[model samples]
Target: MSSPSPKSPELSDHSKKYDRQIRLWGEHGQKSLERANICLINATAVGCEVIKNLILPGIGSFTIIDGNIVTEEDLGTNFYVEKEAIGASKSECCMRLLQELNPDVNGDYLDESIDSLLETRSEFFQSFDVVIASNIKEATLKNLSNLLWDYNIPLVYCRSLGFVGSIRLQFREHCVVEPHPDNKPLDLRIENPFTTLKEHLAVSEVNGKSPWVHVIHKHLVEWKKDHEGNPPKTYKEKNQFKEMIRIAMKSDEENHEEAIKAVNTVFESAGKISSNLSAIFNDEACQKLNTKDKNLQFWVIAKSMQDFIKTENNDLLPLQGVVPDMTADTDSYIKLQSIYRQKAMQDAENVYQRCLNTLLNIGMKNEIISENTVRLYCREASGLRFIRGTKIQSEYSDWDKSTTLAEGLECQQPLMELYAVLRAYDHFYTEFGYIPGESYVEPDTPKLKGLVTKLLQDWNIRHPVSDDMVYEICHYGGAEIHSISAFIGASAAQEVIKLLTQQYVPIDNTFLYSGITTETATYKF
Candidate 1:
């Protein structure tokens, strides 16, 4: 489509509300982001930080589920729950504050524990587009994971313990149509332009005031005719082609330099697939994606595109749906741009229809693939990219992943020893009524230190944690640090957007970050 006119009356309120983000990802991605209904299981600092980010971006709706009453400790951790809300419901306090960030975004609150909600109103979890669970118990998280897995919904598990944070992403096999790869290959279809584009260029004659683009197009047709429809294949032939364009220039003409400059583009034969595209087409995932698959949007677009190419019998990829700048007159440039854009838009529509048919054949419906989705897919046809995250089953069963995860132990940056201490703390919290250490009360440092060692041994981690580090973490009693929560919350929110919009690569399976030293690591099972 042509550039949106600044004064156009067709722009929607959504476009105004999300103007900046719409520029980052296209209107389609913004729409996807706006359509999401996110759920946060806890109203802690990390959770509120994530929700704050999403609320400002105008997500469709969000539900905060927390049954605990706000306490003095909670006030110190979460910014939204002020001292005035000390005895109020955690979910209600956070919901009120987060909703004020953006009135356009809808908000809901369930003043009940996630375990009770899962037991009584289990269907409540299925309606959300994605779920974010933070600071949940191990058994509760496992139950939530299994439920979300059954429903095929994505879940981002986040945790922030004082100075360190970690994240784990779980979803069914996912695909990304537009991972927004850098270094997009040149998409010039000069070798074999589409019918409308070819016809437009065939009769589009060059005048004295015509741009250098017309000069190149005129010689391109002549060279093809002379060489039996073959472009210059080798370096020698390319230079010979350039010399031909140079010889055609008028010596006395003031614009002879423009015609001579057309030589640089005359030999650019680059409309075919790149090595990445070749690999994508031959991917085992692409080969095996069929009726019983997850019905991801990317795979649907890709399979429909395969059908589109097969029917056309043309090996060229779909148009990138772009028009580069040229030295043409205003009218000439618009006309030239329209020719390519119209073909690309038409090709996208064709792909959309084929996608409907593919869905129908697989016992699905047209609603499975939106028109905007297919349109963006075709616009990025040459730039089609996909990423598959590690399965939760694999993350649970993979024993070899310990070596990779253990790399965090090598860095003394902040000491990953807290990971084990937290697990032990959780064990203590479950068995006892309170956490390892409490404020204004003497800390049980000796008992907690012993629990930390036992927990470390249970996990097969050989890292030797110092007595002081364990004491400090326990002494702090896992109170939320605003700086750590701010950074990790923003990071998790970014990943959630990527997953919802399928615009960029999300966290693989695990991410370990230390704000103390700004050290980060990403791992896969």
Candidate 2:
């Protein structure tokens, strides 16, 4: 297709109500959600979070299947149930609150449990595109997993105890995941809630030591620089300063030199104010990322480069492909694409190398940077590639090898270098204090042109570029730290944009975790 179907008109209310979440998922994902018809088998706390997430993304319609009623305990965790709502049907109450979030949603509340529905209305789940079960028993979950599996519907099973949450995704027959080479038992150590909670509460901010406190100092210094007389006192003014830095980073479309300069000025000024302030932005924890693995590096650079693009532009766009109404001859098109395509690949490698070097300088081991265990993604983003003939038998194979551009590629180094520099500032500031060059911008289509410019060069690759090829990495839970969650979400979401937009080579079932260290390994199942 030359262009995506014209987007549905923006709903002002929805835009504001779901502002934060919409910023997370992007418009295309939101559109996928709008076209989605979902089913939730239960309405418990975890399920409620999932529903809230979906509703905020503007799901087209949903069937909430539950027979349970609200209880006093539910009121503590679920936002939907009020004191008056106790004893009312949980699904019904949830539906009402969801409506308040987005009236565009079509909701159906079932006051019957899954067992009852199975007995009387086996087809209850048939209409939904995806089904989520929360507030359900283990046996019920297994049973529903089987049912959803048989019916070819995607099912999400979630449970939470205090601070820890667990989610398992079960898909139907056609869906297959490459299993881990040495299939080990699923890690079932339910984290100790008290220990985790205690750890969170136990941490104290040392003047220049804590990340957030340093940010406070950075903002204060910036305020002092700009406003002259008195510095910020109220939480709101401090917040405004923080926001100003964020907005300044994303306001431009190219690079963020000014943003970088402003942050440095703030950091320098803070140093003069207090010894602790000087220690804040210079924390040892901050390390530049590595680019030897081109993919990782590209992500770092892409984030830094596109911060402004995402903030300034809102259109769903692509960097390369058949331009609308193009009349250039085939030869001319090929020649034009070759120039940009080569540049795209070159750019990817350059960014990757840059990020790699940065990480190494900050302390990441060179061995980890070069190991194939950590995929250096550096091609046009596309879908999770399944091997042409991988059978969906009971046993699964390593599917990562199959999920790539039909033609394999070699690593590009220069692009890696560029990626590292861009990422270093963000990592440095995040560890030290204050927002360095970071910006909060929603991902959009037009920003993708630069990467796709590379894909057009390799026309000989067997895989044809299409929307279905675009991939999205799924995240079910947050990391140990709250701030890390944003980083994780943004990283995963950016990959999805590349996957969907076919701006890079796709990674299949790529799992990225960094709680302890950056450990990346490809798994299928």
Q: Which candidate is the best by lDDT?
A: 1
TM-score of each: 0.78, 0.38
lDDT of 2 by residue, 74-190 (tens): 676667777888888888998888668767788878888888887677767777777766535434555666676666665654444222223334443221111112322211111
How many times do residue backbones clash in model 2? Answer: 44
- Candidate that would win on TM-score: 1
C-alpha lDDT values of all predictions: 0.74, 0.42
Query: What does the lDDT come to for candidate 1?
Result: 0.74
What would the TM-score be for candidate 2 when compared with the true structure? 0.38
lDDT per residue for candidate 1 within 1-525, as digits (tens), equals: 222334856768878878898888878777787899999999989999999998888788999999998999887778888788889898998999889999989999999999998888888888898899888876677778888988889999888877778888998756666777674554657667678767877888775445555666777778888888887777776677767767776654433455565455544534566565666677775666665666555676787787787677287667766766655566776787777788788888888888898778767777878987788877767655555555454443344465543565556434355555665666676766576676432557777777777765655867656787677767666677888888889999999998888777787887778776688877665
In model 2, how large is the Cα lDDT of residue 469?
Answer: 15
Off by over 4 Å in 1: 1-7, 10-14, 119-121, 191-298, 311-313, 356-372, 391-398, 406-476
* Poorest 10 consecutive residues by lDDT, candidate 2: 468-477
